[model samples]
Target: MTLSAAGLGSTTQPLSTVYDLAMLDLDGVVYVGRDAVPGAVKALTEARTNGMRLSYVTNNAARTPHEVAEHLRELAMPEVDDGDVVTSAQAVAHLVADAVPTGSPVLLVGGDGLRGPLEERGLRCVTSLADEPVAVVQGFHPDVGWRQLSEASFAIQAGLPWFASNTDLTIPTARGIAPGNGSLVQTIRNATGASPVVAGKPQKALFDETMERVGGRHPLVVGDRLDTDIDGAINAGTDSLAVLTGVSTLQEIIERAPGQRPTFVSADLAGLNESHLEVELDGDRARCGAATAVVRETVVSLETGEPAGTEALRAVVGLAWSVRDRSDASLTVDGTLGA
Candidate 1:
C-alpha cells in the first residue's frame, strides 16, 4: 500500500492500548549495550500494565531467545521471557524446515542461536558439506570464521538451497560497529555467485514468525534504525515507530526517502503510552497541534506556539516529507526538534 501523503499516522488514543503487540528491536531501543535505556524499564512496565504485549525482535542471530530473555530480565524487564523474544534464527529455521524435509541434515554455519531453532524444528545440524547436507543456513556468530564460511560456500556451490538469518552488513558491538553476517554472506555470495533466501527484517518471514508465535491481532513495529527496522515495517505493511535513542537522528528521519519513512517518531519509549499528534496537510504547509510548518521554494519554515514543542517537530516532519515525496525538493533543517 502506498501510505498516506505525509507517511505519518496520528493517534487519539495511547499506542499501548491501540495495538495488541509491539514488535521491538533490541540493542538500541530497550537497552544500549548491557544497561537498560534510561526510562525503558519503567515505560515498558507501564505499557504491559496497559495490556500491550512486548515482543523483542532482533536481526542479530548470534544469541538465543533464552539468552536474550535473560539479558532483558537482568535489565529489570519483568515482562520479557523466552516466549517474548523473537530471533532471526527462529525465523530462518521455519523457512528451512518448509523447504527441506523434516529430520533432514542442514549444514550449519553459525552457532547455538541457529542450531537450537533448527533442532526444535526437527532438523539436524551438520558442520561439513561432507556430512551429506540437504541445505545450508548461515547466521551471525562470533566464532564463525574462514572454516565455517568455506564449508557454507562448498555446500552452496554443490547446489544445496541456501538460507540466511539476516543480511545486516554491520552490527554494533561493545567496541564499535564491526563486520556482521551480511559481510560474511557477501564473501560467500562473491565466491559462489549465489544469494541465500534471507529470513530477517525487510523480509516478511521474520514478522510472520513472530506473529504466528506471539498471537497478536494488531502489531506495531518499534525500533531505532530506519534502514532495517522501519524498512522492515514498511515491507510487512505495519505501522512503525522510530525511537531516537539509537543510530537514527531526528533530522535524518525528516529527510529520509518515502519508502523508509516511519509511521511515528518519538524520542523515547514513554511515547508508547502517549498520544501521537496529528500532522495535517494545509496547501503548501503542515500543522500539528498549535505548530505549523511551511515550505516556500527550497526553505522549510517552522512556527511553534506555546506548548507545541514536539508538535513543532511533527509539523516539520510532515511538511518536509510531503514536500519531498511530491515535488522531489530538498529541505534543510537546523534547529531543535523540541524533544
Candidate 2:
C-alpha cells in the first residue's frame, strides 16, 4: 500500500503496547560491533516487560542462532535466547527444501550456519557436485574461497538450482566495512550469468520465517538501516520504526525513496515505550508537536517553537518528502537539522 501525503504514519499509543512482537535487525538496531547500542538493553527489557516479544533478525549467515544469542547475552541482553533469533540461513534452508525433495543431497558453499538448517530440513549437505547433489545453497562464511565458488558454478552449469541466504553487499566490522555474501554472489552471477533465489531482507523469506517463529498479530519492525530493515518491513506489509543508533542519518531518512520510508523515527530504542508524534499535513506545511516544516520554491525551512528533537525531524521529513514527490524542488536543509 502507498503511504499518504503525510508519509508512513503516526501513533498516539506507545509502540510496545500496540505491537505484539518486534522483529529487530541486530547489527545496527541492537548492537554496533561488540557492545550494545546505548540504551538498547534497558529499552528492550522495558519493552518485554510491557508485553512485547522481541525477535532478533539478521541477514548474516555466518553465525548460527545460538552464536548470535550468546553474543547478545555478552552484550547484557539475557532475554535473547536461540528461539528469539532468526537467521537468513534458516530462511534459505526452507527455500531450498521446498524446491528439492527431502533427504536430497544439496551442494553447500557456506559454513555450519547453512549446514545446520539444511540438515534440520532433512537435506544432506555435500561439498562437491560429484556427490550427485540436486541443488546448491550459498551463504557468507569466512572460509568460503575459490574452491567452493567453483563447485557452486559447476553445479549451476549442470542445471542444479541455486539459492542464497542474502545479497547484502557489505558487512560492517570493527575495522571497516567488508565484502558480504552479495559481493560473492555477484562473482558467481557474473561468471555463470545466473542468479540464485535470494531469501533475506528486502525479500519476504526472512520476514515470513520471523513471523512463523514468533507469532505477531501486529508486528513492528525495529531497525536502523533504511535499505534493508525498513524496506523489508514495507515488503512484508508491516509497520517499521527507524532508530538513529546505526547506519542511517536524519537527512538520509528525510529523503527516503519510495518503499523505503519508516512508519516511525526515534533517537534510539527508548522510542519503543514513547508515543510517536504525528506529522500533520497543512496546505504547504507539515507540523509535528511544536515544530513545522515548509518547502517554498526550492528551499525547505524548519520553524520550531522549542528545541528540535526527533519529533521535529519527523515534521521536516514529511514536508521534504511530500515536496520532492510532487516536483523537482531542491531541498535546502543545511542549517535545519541540528547535530
Candidate 3:
C-alpha cells in the first residue's frame, strides 16, 4: 500500500490477506455500549478465519480485559479471552511500572481496571493520599467522582508522579455523549496545574504496548474515531482503517490534513474482506470505481454511478484534499455523502 496524503490504497487481495494482525478499537468499531454493531461478529470471525490475529486494543480503561472479553463472547463473538484484549489501563500500568519502585503504593483514581494491572505489575493501589502513595494514576469509571479527583488533586499538587490512561474528553454512552477520563483529568489538572504522563491513543505508548504483547509483523489499526484511533495509528506510523459504524462521518474525514487521515475507509467491519478501490485523481476531479467527484468552484460534488456511496466519498475526499493541498480554498461537501 502506498502511504501518502489523500492516498487511499487499493489491493488486489483483501485487507485480511494483506495484514498479519488487526489491532481493534472498541466502542464505535466493534460494539457500542452493551451491544455489538450489526455484522460485527460475522466480520471478525471471517477476519480470524482468514488467519489474521485479532487483538482488541482499546483506550477505554473502565473495564478489565476479562470483562471486555466476556462482553464480546456474550454478544456472540468468537471465543475471545482476556489475554487477547489490551487496555489503556494495562498501557499506563506498564509506563508506571517502568518508572516507579515495585510494590509501591499508587493513588488510583479509577476502578479495578487500573487496580488489576497495577497489582499485576507489582504496584499497590490505594485510594487516599493519606496512604502515603508514591504516585497517582487515573483512568475512567462511571463511579469516579469528587472525592477521587480531590485525592488525585492533592497528590498531583504535592508533585507526585502522575500517569493517566488517556485524555479523551468525551465518551459515548447508551444515553448520549458524557465526560470521559480525560475530562475528569482536566479537572485535576486545572486544580493542580499539572499534566499526567498520558499512555493512550494519539500517544505512541499504547500502540507500542499492543505491538509488544500481540507480536505482529504487519498490523492494521482499525477504529471509528479520527483523533484517537486513526491519529494514534499515524503517530505510531501504522496503517489504519476508519470504519463508519461509529462517531466520525465521511464528510468530516475527507477534510482533514493528509497526515491525519486513515490509510483506508469502510462502511463497517465487513470491508475487511473486500478489495479496496484506489481513488484516482485527474485535474480538479477524482474517481474511484464507477463513482466520480468534481470540484465546481468551492463546492465538491460526488457524481453517482454503479457503486456510489463510499466510492463516491473516496473520490470526493481525494479531490477535496487535493484541492486543499494546492490552495487555501475551503471545500463544501455537505450533502454529497449519502449519494
Candidate 4:
C-alpha cells in the first residue's frame, strides 16, 4: 500500500451537500458514555435538514438497535430510529446464519443483544456444546463469566464456526475505559488457541450492511477513531471525517499510517456544514487557511498560526505527514503550537 499521508485531495462543497449518506460512529462521534458530544445533536439535526441521511453504525454489541436509538432520543437526537442504527451483533448473527442451516443451534456467549440477532435469523442460541451447536458467537457483556467462555472454548475446540460481534479492545464508559469484547475474545482465543471472524469496525461486514440498510449512493463515514472508524472507511473504500471530540489526537494525526488518515478533520460534528481548505505545500512549508507550518528534516515548526484551531493543525499535520512519508523518518513537533 502506498502510504501517502499528506496533500489529500480538497473538497469544494460542504460534505453535507456532497454525500448522500453519512455513516456515523455512535460512541465517540455522536455521544460519549450516556451524554451527547458537545454540539453533536444540533449538528446532526442541521445535516439532516441539508438532505444528508445519517445512519449510526456501532461496534458495541451489548445493546440492541432499539436501545441505542432510545438512548440517542434521550440525548435530544430525535432523528435517530431503530432502523437507522446497525450494530455488530446484527452483522455477526448474519455471518453465523449464512454458514449454518436455518434454525440451527448456535452457542452464544454474550448478552441479549447477541441472542436477539441470532434468534431473528432463525438460529437457536444454545449455551452448551452438548446442545449440538453448529457454531459459537461471542461478544462482550458484563454478565459473561468464565463459565460461558469455557463452554465457548469447548465448542470452538471441536471446530465449530466461531464469530465475534466486535473486537474493540477498550470501551469507554462513564467510569472510564473498560475492557471491551476484543479483550474478552482473547480469553477464549488463548484457551482454545483459535481466532474468531470479527464483524465490527475495521471489518467490511458492518459497513456493507449499513450501506445496504441506509441505501447511500455516496456515503461519508463520520467517526472519532483512527484504527476502527477511519481505517474501516478505508477498508470500505469510503471517505471519512475525523472528529477530535474523542480518542484521537493531533499527535495521532501527525503520524497517521496509510489507511489511517481521514479526508477531513474537525473539532466537532459542526464541520459537516463547512468547507475544508486544502493544505498548500511550498517546498518544506505547508499552509492552510491563515496557518503556516514548516518541516525541516524530521522537525516541524509552526511559525505563526491558530495553534489550537483546526486549520492550523491541518497545515501542520500535512507537513509532518509529508516529511515522514518522504524519508520514512519520524516527526517531532517543535512545541511552538500551544494546546
Against the true structure, what is each candidate's TM-score?
Answer: 0.91, 0.91, 0.95, 0.93
Judge candidate 1 at residue 300 and give its lDDT.
65
lDDT of each: 0.85, 0.84, 0.85, 0.83
Candidate number with greatest TM-score: 3
**C-alpha-based local distance difference test score of model 4:** 0.83
1-339 per-residue lDDT for model 1 (tens digits): 123446777887788999989999987788877888889998899899999999999988988999999999998995677999999999999999999889999999999999999999999999999899999999999899999999999899999999999998877655667888899999999999999999998788899999998889889999888878888999998999888877777778878886678988777787788777778887678887788888777766776542224566667778888888887887776454534
Off by over 4 Å in 2: 1-5, 257-259, 282-285, 294-302, 305-308, 335-339
Q: Which 10-residue window in model 2 sums to the lowest lDDT?
A: 1-10
Per-residue CA lDDT of model 2 for 43-77, tens digit only, reads: 99999999999999999899899999999988887
Error of 1 at 314 (Å): 1.6
Is 1 or 2 the stronger prediction by lDDT?
1
Q: Higher-TM-score candidate among 2 and 3?
A: 3
TM-score of 4: 0.93
| Residue ranges of candidate 4 with Cα displaced over 4 Å | 1-7, 296-301, 334-339
Could you report the Cα RMSD, in angstroms, for every candidate shown? 2.7, 2.5, 1.7, 2.6
Q: Residues 55-127, candidate 4, lDDT per residue (tens digit)?
A: 9999999888899999998998847779999999998888888888998999999999888988999999989
For candidate 4, which ten residues in a row score worst on lDDT? 1-10
